[model samples]
Target chain A: MGDLLRRCLMKRTDPDAPQKRRRGAAVALWGVMALLVLWALFNLRAIGDAFVQFHAFLAYRFIRRALIVGMLVSLCASLLGVTLVLKRYSMIGDGLSHVGFGALTVAMALGFVTSEGLPAFLPQGLRGAVARLCAGIAANPLPFTLVIVVVCAFLLLRISEHSRMRGDSAIALISTSALAVGVIVTSMTSGMNVDVYNYMFGSILAMSTSDVYVSVTLSAVVLVLFALFYPRIFAVTFDEMFARATGVRAGGYNMLIALLTAMTVVVGMRMMGTLLISSLIIFPALSSMRLFSSFRAVTISSAIISVACFALGMLLSCVYSLPTGAGIVAINLVVFIAFSAIDATR
Target chain B: MALIAIQDVTIAFEGTVAVDRVSFEVARGDYLVIVGENGSGKSTLMRAMLGLVKPRSGRIVYGDGLEKNRIGYLPQQTAAQRDFPASVEEVVLSGCVNRMGTRFFYNRADREKALGNMKLLDVERLRKKSYRTLSGGQQQRALLARALCATDAMLLLDEPVTGLDPNAAAEFYEVIRSLNRDHGVTVVMVSHDLSGAMRDAGKVLVMNRGMDFFGSLEDYRTRFAEGMVKGHG
Candidate 1:
C-alpha cells in the first residue's frame, strides 16, 4: 500500500510515458470527433428541413429574436461562469436572478400604477420625470431590472467579503427575500400579473424588439470587455490573493465579473425566465470542465457547448411546445451527464 | 539601506490583532526566514510586506528598487486552489501582470521572462501541462517559477513547503537556497520548518503572535538552544 501510494504521488521520472499516452489519447479523441462531424454532415438535409419548418411559424420573428438573445446570453454566461464557479460563487447567479425577478415585478407594478393612478402627491416636474422613467420601463423592463440586479450583485459581493456572512448564507438571505418581494409585488399588481408570470416562466414569443436590441448591445459589451481583460481575469480567477500581491487589482476585476454576470442574468431572463436562467450560467461551464483541463480550452469549449445547447433546446421547445427555459436546462443536463460519463471513462 | 523596513507594524483582522508591534528589516540579498507555530502571525507579517494586508498601525517602507508589487509572492495553497483550471504556462505568465502596467496584453518580453523563469525552475517541460495534474513538488516549482516571473529583486513565500514529503521538501529548500545564494534574489519566507529554513537563511525571525527573537541564525540557535532542549525533553 505504501509503495503504491509513493509511486502514485511521486513525479513520474520516465518523461516519455506521459507523452506517448497523451499522443494516443489525442489521436483517439480526434478520430471520434471526425466521425461525429461526418454523421452531422449526413443529416444536414433533415436539420435544414426542421429549421425551414421552424421559420414557417407566424411567431417566428420573436422566436428568432429569442434564439439570438439566448445564444448571446449563453456565451456570456458560460465565459463568466468559469470564473464564478471556480471561485465558489456559482450561487451568486441564482441570487441575482431572483433579485432580477423582484425588480421586474416592481418595475411592472410601478409602470401599471403610473399609467393608471395619477399619484396626486407628486409635483408636476417630479411626476413628469417619474412618468417618463416608468414609461421607459413599461416599454422594456430590462433596464430597470439591470439596475436592480447590478446593485444587488455589488451588495452581495460586499457583504460576502466584509461581513461575517458566508457566501452561501448571503446568497440564501438575499435570494429568499428577493423572491418574497417578487411574489408580493406580483400579487399587488392586478392587471400585469400575466406579464409577471410570463417573465417568471419565460415566453420567447413575448420578447419585444427593444429587449432583443438591449440584449445584443449589452452582450457585445460583455464579450469585448472579457476579451480585453482576459489575462487579468485569468489571474484573478486562479489566485485572487496572489493576483492582488502582484498588483493585478483583483477587486476591480471581481467587480467587473459581478457587473457582467448581472447583465447576463437580466438579459437572459427574457428567454430563460428568472427562475431557470442561472442554469445557463452553471451548466455549460461545468459540463466543459469535465472534459477540459486548461482555462482557455474549458472557456472556449463551454461557450460552444452553451450555444449548441441553446440551439437544441430552442428546437425542442418549438417542436414540443415546451417552456423554452426548461427545455434549455434539460438539454444542458443531458450534455453535462454525457460529458461526466466520458470523463469518468478517461 | 534595507530593501524593506517594517517599523512597528501591526496587522489585525476585524479589529482583532493577529500580529502586534512587529518590527524587522530585510537587507538586499538577505535570506530572512520567519519561523513560528500555527497562529503565530508569520504569514500575516509576510502579507503586510506584500501589501495584501494593511498594517493597523506603523508602516512598512521600501528602499532602492523594492516597492509595492515589485516583489514575487508564493501564497499558501489549499486543495481547491491547487485544482484551478489553468496551464502551467498561463499560471507562470500571470506573474507578469504587474509589469504589464496599463497594457492589457502580455508583450514578447513578458513571455520571454516567463519562459526564462520556467527554465530556471526546471518546469519548462511542464509548461503546456495542466497545473492541477502536477505532483506536489512540481506544483510548488511551477508556482515558484510564477513568482520568479514577477520580480528579480525579491521573493516572499508563505509556508511554501507545507504539504511536501521529506524528499521533495529538501529539494524545494535547495532550489530556494540557490535562488538566494547564486541569483542574488532576497527572500523572506514564512515557514514552520525552522531547521530547514535555518540551514539556508542568513537571518531568522521567531514569532508567537509577536516577535520573540530576530537576529542571525547562530544567535537564534545559541539564545534558544536551552529552551529547545527543554521543550524536547
Candidate 2:
C-alpha cells in the first residue's frame, strides 16, 4: 500500500508518458470489464441453480426483477456520479439516501398500520373506508417515501445554496437529524422488526413487485433526462459561473440534478439499503476517473463499471448467502482498488 | 451607438458597497483596460456587465444588436477546472451553448465556428488534447477560443494573464491586440499589470471602488502614471 501511494504521488519522467499511460490504463480497465462478462457467461447455469436453491417459489421471477432493477439503478447512479463527484456533491447523494431511509421509516410508521388507533367518534362507513386506505398504504409505502425524500432533496439544495453553512455541513445537519427521527420513530412504533432491518441493510426479499415497476420507470426517466441534458450538465459541472454567464440557467440545472439524484436514491435504496446506496454513486465514478482522462470516456466507462459491479455482486450474494448490499459494495471496492493499482503502475 | 452603456452602476454585497456610482461606455472596436487595486470592484463591475450580478441602482443598456449573452467572456480560472476531465474541443464547443438555446446539441455551424476560433487562437492542434493537460498559456488560449465562439462583437476578459510567464503573457497580449485591430472586435480587459496592459489600450479606466479616472490613454499617461508609479514603488 505504501509503495502504491508512492507510485501515485510521484510524477513519472518517461519520455512517452501521457499517451502510453492512457492507453495502458484503458487496456487494463477494459480487460477487467471483459473478464466480468466472460465469468458471468461461464457461471450462468451455476448461478441460476444457486438462486433456485436459495428461494423456492417465484425464484426465477425474483432474480430477473432484481437484475433488471439493480442494473438500471446502478447505471443511473454511475452516470450521475461523474457529475456529482466532479462537483463535490457526492455527499449530497449520501445525505439524500439517508433522507430516503428516514422517509421510508416514517412512511412505515405512518402507513404500515391500520386506522385502528383513530379517534372514537368516527362514523362506521367512513371508518371502514379509512381502514381500507390505511391497508393499501401499509402494503406499499414507496409513494409516501418518494414524496418525502424528493421534498427533502430540494430543501437540501436550497439550504446549501443560500445558507452560511458549508455544503457538507448542511448535509450533515439534515441527514443526521433525519436519521435521528427515523431511529426514534422506529423505536417507538415498529420495535426493530425484520422489515425495518431489511430496509436498513438491504435484502433481496425487500423488493416488492411494485418496487420493480417504480425502479424501472424512475430509472428510465433519469436516463432520458441525463441523455437529453448531457451537454448542459457538462458545461455546468465544468464552470458553473461561466455557464451561467453564457445563459445556461445553471441554477435550474442544479435543481434538475437534485431532483434526479433524489429519484435515483429512493429507487436504489430498495435493494442497496440506505447505509450503502451511496457507494453506488461514488465508487464507480472514482475508479473510472483513475483510469480515464476525458469526460466522455470517464462517464461511459463509469456506467459500464457500475452495472458490471452490480451484476457480479448480485450473483456472488445469491451463490454465497451474503447480504446483497454488502456484496455489491465489496465488488465495487475491489474494482476501485484494481483501477487504482493499474493507474499507479502506469 | 455605443455597444454597451453603463449608467451610474452601484453594486453592494451584504450591505457593503463594492462598486459605487460608476459609469462608462464601451464603443464598438474599442480596446478598454480597467486598472485597479485589489477589492476595487473591477471584477464586480465586469460581472455586472455580463449580467451575472445585478447592480443596485443602474442599468447596462446594450445596443448595436448586442445582447447580454452574446458577448464573449474569458473569466479567471477556478480550482474546479484545474483538474477537470474535458477535451479542448468539448470546452470550446461549450462556448456556443448560449446560441444553442433549447437545442440539445451543437449544430454544424457551431462546430465550424468552434474550429475557426480554435485555429484563430492557434490551439487547433490541441483540440483533441485533454484540457487539463495543456500548458497554462495553451489552456488560456483554449478558453479564449471558447469565448470567441460565443460572439464576434466583444470580449470581456477578467485577469487573463494573472499567472502567466512574461513570454506567454506577451503572446496573449499580441493575440488580443490582433483581434482588436484586424478583426474589429471590442475588448474590455481587467488587469493589474498596468505597464504592459496599458501599452495597446485606447482608453483606460482607473478604478478605486469607483471611477477614479476614465479617459484616453494619453490623458491617463499624463495624469495618473506618476502617481501610480510612486504608489507602487
Candidate 3:
C-alpha cells in the first residue's frame, strides 16, 4: 500500500541512509524496465508486417527508439512535475496538450512538411488530400508550427494569469477550448475525418522516424537544460522567496519552465495526440511515485515507468485491436488503481 | 553604524494597510526583535525588508551595503514549500547557487562550506534525508542551514521558533544570540515572545500597523511599547 509509495516517493534524501540501498533501488527499477521491453519484444508480431518491415528494422532499433524516447520524456516530466505538483500547477500538462493539438491543427491547415512524414491517420488518399490542403495553407511547416504554438501559449498565459485561477482549472478550460477548436476546425475542413480520432487516441505503431527524432531531440535539450539549472530550479521549488533573495532569479526560471513546457507539449503531441499527451507526462510520474524517494530517484523511476508503459501499450493495442492512445492511458490507469489499492493496504 | 533604516513605509493589501508609515533604524549586530500581535504587520515588515512586496511610500536603506546573496532568511512554514523534494543537503546547497557566479560543478570548497554550515546547525545527520521528512523544529534548522549557506552577514528570522517547545525555543534563541555575539551576524527576529527575547536583544521595535515603538532594550523594559496610540487591529 502506502508503504511501497512511502519507500519511493518521499525517500530522496536521507542523510543517514547507506549508499548501497539507493543503488539497489536504482538497479531494481532498471530490472523492471528490462523485463517490460523483453515482454513487448516477444509480442511485437502483431504490428502488421508492412509498416514494421519498411520502417521498424531489427527489433533492437525499433525498441530502442520507443524505450529511449519514452524514458527521456518521462524523466524530464518527473523532474518538472514534482515542482509543478507541489506548486499546484500539475494541470498545466493537460492544458499544454490541447495547445499542442491546436498547433497541430494549424500545422495541418498551413501545410508544413517537417520531414516527420505524413499523418498516419485516415485513408492513404485522404492523407495525401489533407497534405494538399495543408500545402495550400502555407509552403513551410516551421512557421505553421511557430504560429500555432505562440498563439496557444499566449492564450494559456492570459488564462492562468488574469484570474489567479487554479492551474488545474486553467489547464482543463484551455485544453477543452483548444480541443473543441481542433474538432470544429478539422470537421469544417472536410476530408480530414479520421484526423481528430487518430490524434485523440494515438497510434504508436504509426510513430514515424521523424516523430521520434523531434521528440527525442526536444527531450535531450530539456535534460541538458534541467541538469545545468538543477540548483536554481531546486531552490525555486523549495523556497521561491529564498531563491529570489539569494539571487536565483526565480521569476526568470519559472518563465523558462513555462516556455520549455510549451515546447515539450508541441513536440510530444505528434506521439500521444492532444487528448492523451498529459497522460504520457503524468502516468509515469504517478507510477514511479510508488518506488522512488529523491527527486533524482523519481526522475529515474518515471523514465522506467514510461518506457514500460509505452512498450506494453503498443503491443496491447495491436493484440486487442484497441485504440493505441486510449490503450496506453487505460493501462496506466489500471496500474495506478492497482497501486493505490496496495498503497491503501500499507 | 546602523544596519537597517526605514522611513515612512506603508504596505497594503486590497485597500487595507497591513503596515502603515512604519519607520525604524537598527545598528549593526543590534539584535532588533519585533513584537506584535497576529496580523499586526510584523511579517509584512519583514517581507518588506526582503523585498517580497513593494511599500506604498518611503524607503528602506541598509548601511551594510547589502549584497544580493548576503542576507540569511528564515520564513514561516509556507504551504508552498512543505512538499519540495530536495534532500536536506541539496536544500542547503542552494545557498551556494547564487554565489557560484560561473557555471560548472559547485567547486568542492563551496560544498564543504555548506556541509560545515549544516553541521553547525546540527542537521548534518539529516543531510541525506528528504527535506519534507524532518519535523517542524528540525525543518527550521535545515532552513537555517540553507540560509547560513547564502551569507555570513545579517540573519532574519520570521517566527522561526514558533512550533518548538520552551526548551527548544530557548535553545533556538541562544543560537541566534551566539550568531549575533560570536559570529557578529546581525539578527532581526520577528516574535510574539516579547518578554523572553528581550534578554539578549540590544534594541526592540514594537510594530503594530507599522513601527509603533522603537527603543533600546533598556528603554523597552522601562516602558513597554511607550505608547500604542497609532496601531493596526
- Best of the candidates, lDDT: 2
Worst 10 residues of 3 chain A by lDDT: A49-58
TM-score of 1: 0.89
The TM-scores of all predictions, comma-separated, are 0.89, 0.88, 0.78
Runs with alpha carbons beyond 4 Å of true place in candidate 1: A1-52, A55-59, A112-136, A191-193, B228-233
Residues B1-233, candidate 3, lDDT per residue (tens digit)? 56777878999988999999988876676788888888889988988887777888888877767663677888887786665656788888878876788774577878998999988889999888887778877888888888888877788888888778888788888878888899888899998776667779998888779666788877776664455343411
What TM-score is obtained for chain B in each of the predicted models?
Answer: 0.95, 0.97, 0.89
Considering just the first chain, candidate 3 attains a TM-score of: 0.67
Better of 2 and 3 by DockQ: 2
CA error at residue A26 for candidate 1, angstroms: 19
Q: Model 1, A1-346: lDDT tens per residue?
A: 9987877777566547876776676566556656766887998987787677666653667777888888888999999998998888899999999999888888877766452356777677787787888877866677788989999999999987888878799899999999899888878775456677777888787667777787798789988998989999998888888899988888888898999999999888867988899998899889988888899999999899999999888987887688999999998987876676566557
**On residues A1-346, what C-alpha lDDT tens digit does candidate 2 reach at each position?**
9987777777575546877877777677667767876997999998688767656532578877887888988998998899999988899999998888888777777665554677668876787787777666566777777788889888988888888889899999999998888898899987889877877888876666777887788788888888888888998998887788888899998888888888888888978888999999999999998888888999999999999999888877777878899999999987886787677666
Residue lDDT tens for model 3, A1-346: 8888787787886645755655565565555556766876876774455345433432656545654555555556655665666556667777877766666676565544422356666677777776676685554343455456656665665576556776557768777887777777666564365665666655544455665776677778888888887777777877888887776777677767766776666555555666776777777666655544466666666666666676666555555656766767777766665454443333
In model 3, where do residues sit more than 4 Å from their true spots? A1-72, A106-147, A150-163, A205-210, A318-321, A330-346, B12-18, B165-168, B193-199, B225-233
True contacts kept of 3: 0.54
Sorted into a CAPRI-style docking class, model 2 comes out as medium
lDDT of 3 at B124: 91
State which candidate has the highest TM-score: 1
lDDT for every model? Answer: 0.86, 0.87, 0.70
Q: Fraction of native Cα contacts kept in each candidate?
A: 0.76, 0.56, 0.54
